[model samples]
Target: MYSTHLSPMQTYLVSENLKKMVSEDWRREKLHSNIAYFKTKMKNANRTVMPSGSAIQPIWIGDEKVALSVSEQLKQKGIWLTAIRYPTVAKGAARLRLTLTTDHTHDDIDFLVKSLVECTYD
Candidate 1:
């Protein structure tokens, strides 16, 4: 997914390769291991400081929608959001991106967090 953000067209392109990699036994195993590592890292990180929308899983909305929405949000403000989307996942599985980092204000997070929460249930 990080690879998707490296270039604009990468997601549309790499998704094909990603499917191929998963089809291969060895590659699939390696990918699973890598995913586990990152999942653990993301899960274990202290996210208390992050805004509500910045948490993992349920709060996130996947890459395409996330990228589009984040772009709109940033244009109004000035923060960049990173999203994790499907094809990299099984169908129907997607995430809304959030991060607990050193560079945001409560107010900055306030709008985003509020909006994301509203969007989720909607």
Candidate 2:
């Protein structure tokens, strides 16, 4: 028995569009490449890039106060990043989480890296 269900139209649309979605392999490769680029650039800017097994990379910013400050600054620059702390992560591990998506372009990644560096310094 099905525990969940989708309407007939939903099922048909999902089936038809499944192949159009980004492939798992492509997403993995792109995520790794972007993470590597950010790691290097952020390190140069004195920011920490927390290692992760998935596309979500947490950039430690010392504490919640700093994380929030950085998040707001980045937001002002048109970059929306979430600040993670407390219940989400341990105290003193406050960070800004960056998620890489298949829809993001290399230039987009570059802009993020540049913006991050600028924001941290400013």
Candidate 3:
């Protein structure tokens, strides 16, 4: 009878997590705080951040190769950022998609921005 086929335990865990997130105002406050923190860190690193109030932050690198290379370097550093390129977006608009989460710490975000600056700016 379950359309999604989730087990009862699965449903319970999911519901509990959702309730916790809602009770803590995850959407209105936490997401905003994370985004703001990310934006500030990126800006402090001399990176221009497009206004984004969401969890996903797309940082434009402009060149396909640069974006791919940076992404590879980040991967080697134990980060899992992805490079976005043509077909998914217009040419010359290559970018790295950074996903911020409630689980990310300030140190985590700082390290990411620092790594990106080293990869792209230096």
Every candidate's lDDT: 0.46, 0.77, 0.82
Give Cα distance to truth, residue 110, candidate 2, Å: 1.7
Q: Give the Å shift of residue 103 in candidate 2.
A: 1.7
- Compared with the true structure, model 3 gives a TM-score of 0.78
The 10-residue segment with the lowest total lDDT in model 1: 46-55
Q: Please provide, for model 3 over 33-72, each residue's C-alpha lDDT reduced to its tens digit, 9 standing for 90 to 100.
A: 8889999898888886656767889997888998899899
RMSD of 1: 11.9
- Cα lDDT of candidate 1 equals 0.46
Best by TM-score: 3
Comparison by lDDT, 2 against 3, better one: 3
Please give the RMSD to the true structure for each candidate, in Å: 11.9, 6.5, 5.9
State TM-scores per candidate. 0.36, 0.70, 0.78
Q: Which runs in model 1 stand beyond 4 Å of their true positions?
A: 1-79, 117-122
